[model samples]
Target: MIDADDVRRIALSLPETVEKEAWRMPTFRVAGRMYLTVPDDETSIAVRCPRHEREELMAAEPEKFWVPPHEASSAWVRVRLAALEDLAELRDVVVDSWRQAAPDRLREAHPALVPGAEAAGGR
Candidate 1:
């Protein structure tokens, strides 16, 4: 099953990614902007997600995605690690959040990491 360690591994694999402590938890950042955070219990992750997409994701899969009341106004969503399908799904989700926080130059330099890049022949 995908776990906190898997999250860390996939996040760190991204270009220019770094791990930092915030709110007493581990937060993954790119370009100094936080994109992923593993909460205290390490069972869930808060990731950068546009409000619109976040709502749709939660509505589509409430078991896998949600947001705490305090973070409702933020563009972020909490994902349950156990609900994730596999490591590939975890990588996809983490990479998507990383893309949101990554600078344009970094994204451009790492096209293979971008979602759907493989189908577009990036890899």
Candidate 2:
């Protein structure tokens, strides 16, 4: 399961990144765009997801994921590591969150990160 340290490491893995304490958590941003949040009290994390994909993701993994309290429907989802055992999948989700928050121009320049991400396809 992914922990706060894991989240910190992953967030720092991306280029031009910084961690700021916001929303009572460690918020990770790239060029001022937020992608991930390290929870203050748990191993779970809040990630920026495509608004359109939020419901689908919650439905698919209701236990492991949820639209964070007060932030549901705002393109943010909180994922609990307790139920999600696959760290690789979590890594992908975190990366995708970073992709969403990244500027379109950067996404284009770094197409290798999120393959087909800027091609207007897949989650």
Window of ten residues with lowest summed lDDT in model 2? 114-123
lDDT string, candidate 1, 18-76, tens digits = 99998899999998999999996999999999999999999999999999999999999
Q: TM-score winner among the candidates?
A: 1
User: Candidate 1, 112: how far from true, in Å?
Assistant: 1.6
lDDT of 2 by residue, 16-99 (tens): 679998877789998898888877586688888777788888889899888756786587888887776665666677778888
Model 1 stretches astray by more than 4 angstroms: 116-123
Which stretches in model 2 have alpha-carbon errors above 4 Å? 115-123
Which structure among the candidates has the greatest lDDT? 1
